[model samples]
Target: MEDRLLDKIAEPFNLQLPEYETLEAMIDGILPAVARFSEPNLLPEDSPLYVNSWVRMTDRPGATEVVMYRFQGYQQGEIRVVTDGEIGSKAYEVEESGDRIIVGESIMRDSFLYELSFIDDDFLILRRHGNLANIPHPYLFFCREAIGTRLTWNEALERLVDKYRNSQFPLLAVGLFVAAMIALLIYFR
Candidate 1:
């Protein structure tokens, strides 16, 4: 009976029952629910688009993992970490500071902080520290954006630049424009 039920569910996707079982197992055992729950609404509507830094420590020595963090309120705001050629479960933290901004204890010592920059109907941006300027590729830590919101990429970038003036990368604006062009090319091509 269970096999029959599984086959019925798998048929629409052209997957065998065993394949479905494997997928179900992977989703249930390995994937974190928070990450899964946060996946669907990554970007919000009319949100600004920005490029933020994402960092993760590597088992290797002296190499910090760097990834592009896209601020899209129309999509979803979940930040995912990928390391060692494997994508891990999303990071979640309980609020210790009674504020909307939250940081995990693991990174609190590094002065890591995440903020929800804007939550208006048409703009949202979550900014974080970027790669070290001097280092070619330093191990990045505590790079994340909160989930939930809708803002456009341009709007997100503007908000980030405005709020974190000190942390704004010098070439951020130019970089953003170029990146957008590249994305459009790839997307349309």
Candidate 2:
């Protein structure tokens, strides 16, 4: 029965038992820290203590434009957002299975800190907290196709230098001409 329960929970996110266990343990560890903010009296209907935000990044090398949501509540509560790019949607359907969990999504597993949760409806909410005291806000980035394309550092530097050179030559020439005129005026005056 426990296995089945785990399977049912893991089916949507395509998470293995061990992975889910790790996540559960992590949540348990942080629960104590957020307990103070979870008080029913503290949360207001109109201005609930928790705030949700979204973030999408583009124009990075070897990365795709992604839309992610974040929720901030307690000072120590954590959330994670997982996407199809890193973990294919076939494994985890955000629309269908994401509503089952109560927390945020687990996007990437980098060294950077993240807030992870699985909503009841199966949509994952990944919250990233910038400041402890400040209410968390979502950051969304929509990049053009040009911004999505990857450019090597060398190529980018070369392009930048080319542009700088093209734009700077005219300004430099104008400056020199102005200086020459000033010199001539001084010589004659």
Candidate 3:
């Protein structure tokens, strides 16, 4: 059942999970990774992009559906609700069958399926699994320190995401994805 899902998700990214013959293998490989984000408090104040909280770079609405995700322990809680005067006090776990990684409690457990399909120095793409996802997209794009909570990306982030969009929109629509680590270094630097 999930193998077909993997096929659909992996094709565009040009990925193959041939090594893991069954869902259990996928779970075993991903289990240790959960330990990394399981505890965020222990991490240093300055976490590099990959290890830091990844806000949704993909368009949906509001803030990054994922307030934060940690690599190397996972955090437990709800996705943040950052408003003008509010810095959401709590922020979000990982588990379950065929899911690459599942982390957090509350809305997270049932709402998202984060399978770590691709990661480079700056790009992190999660392939969604399960029909439980409330969101519409099959893939969620995120980058560290994305300016969220507002209705839209900040001007700088908007420009950054757009550049990648413009560059790859054509390919993406046709199912050929070209990952551009849009504004990865330029915006933060």
Candidate 4:
């Protein structure tokens, strides 16, 4: 039953039992560290754009405290919030299951999958593995540089448009629009 449970947990992340075990060990060993999300351009093109955020993990006696600091925006003069919460593992082991770590808030619960894909002293990456994630790539790159950088709404929109510029969809749409305009002009002439 334990083995079956492990399999079910690892299925979504596409990790083997041994790999998950290794990941679990790695996460436990690297406690009490902060992982800030990387700058927008450095991440995958389709990755969600955050104003700036840092997740601090502190190992406790039986549970780990995960604190998140997200920069909402700079409009109202340094808008930010720090949410402190404990990491629960009763239903599934967060270190291996690659599940959403509910930090009490429903709004923030499904923001990121909260799985540690890679971790080290300098940097660590997590997979945004949740239903609400709308990224083309599921990886969330976090590093020390992502600490205090705040992104504006216009910047985020520009990044999204830039991501699709290399794709065929934008070009096709432009061509169709131009063709229709030419047809109308010729018929009127």
Candidate 5:
């Protein structure tokens, strides 16, 4: 069942998974490469599109191994992205199940197509197609230069909020801070 789904996702891109005796071997081979998609693509023309992704291997309970993955992209003019150059991200806890790399439980739907078109020490290419049949070529090609050395999830979230607050509504954020300070003074008095 999973194999069929993987085939279906790879069909549009005309790709085949590299021959590997075991899924573990495939996962281990690809995990080290940080896949990035930065070129402006034809798809999602309405928005500026870019994808930055990386996989982190963790030995966690419940599965053979867990992959902590981060996918951050920009939709041109997305408030924080434009002002701060900091785009929000989608984090996935992934695992290997059969011939598929399974994206585990999250707020997102469990089922999404992920296929490795190519992977090497410095470059990684992947194709992702979701149930949203409207968008085209979720495929991404990335270079190692795009990947960050150490960026935490909390830092990603905080950076996003900070960018939006300062860029989109600077006046409001400042006003609220001033009002809070004034209120504190009155309380103390």
Candidate 6:
């Protein structure tokens, strides 16, 4: 079934999963990369939008593999994807040290550090800690957002920005705007 139908079945149950419990929970084949930070060379704060890509990741007894993938603009509407039958699964592990959690393949291949900036049931953001991925992104590891339905181009631009924004960024921006306006008024008086 497409995401929308699968989503409908799950949505009616109001099955909001439990709050993120631990590092291992993050890797148990639940959260897939729905969106990724845009690729233009720029800061996250300056990124225009995140890109949409449906990544199908599967897990077996002791391994996980990114089985299928597709990009948004490349194949719009419906699910036309490139399936990799030979991208064999790899052993995975999650290790915790104080507040830090490092997770990746068992041998640390294609590995990345847990993002410190944000985490929630709705999103999984990763950062390579200034390191680069095989297909490097501007933000190294970046933010992701997903939905059950296709999005318009404009909607695509906003989803990732909203998903990864600090709760305070928007509020602080408004505050700064008001402060700047007040200062200008006083100076003109």
TM-score per candidate, chains pooled: 0.22, 0.20, 0.35, 0.23, 0.27, 0.30
- List the global CA lDDT of all models: 0.34, 0.33, 0.42, 0.36, 0.36, 0.35
**Model 4, CA-based lDDT:** 0.36
lDDT tens readout by residue for model 1, 1-189: 547745664453352222222212322222232222121222423323324433321234444444333332222233444454465433233233312232332434433444342332222323233443643322122222331122322233333333343233456665676578668768988
Off by over 4 Å in 2: 1-50, 65-67, 85-189
TM for candidate 1 is 0.22
Relative to the true structure, candidate 3 reaches a TM of: 0.35
Q: Please name the candidate that would achieve the greatest TM-score relative to the true structure.
A: 3
Candidate 4: residue pairs that collide: none
Model 4, stretches more than 4 Å misplaced? Answer: 1-110, 130-134, 145-189
Error of 6 at 26 (Å): 24
Task: Indicate the residue-level lDDT of 175 in model 6.
Answer: 63
> How many clashing pairs per prediction, in order?
31, 34, 12, 0, 2, 0
Better of 1 and 3 by lDDT: 3
Q: Which TM-score value belongs to model 5?
A: 0.27
Compute the lDDT of residue 134 as modeled in candidate 6. Answer: 58
> Which lDDT value does model 5 have at 175?
67
Off by over 4 Å in 3: 1-50, 60-85, 89-92, 95-99, 107-109, 131-135, 146-189
Among all windows of 10 consecutive residues in model 1, the one with the lowest summed lDDT is 33-42
Superposing every Cα of model 3 onto the true structure, what RMSD results? 16.5
Top lDDT hit? 3
Worst 10 residues of 6 by lDDT: 70-79
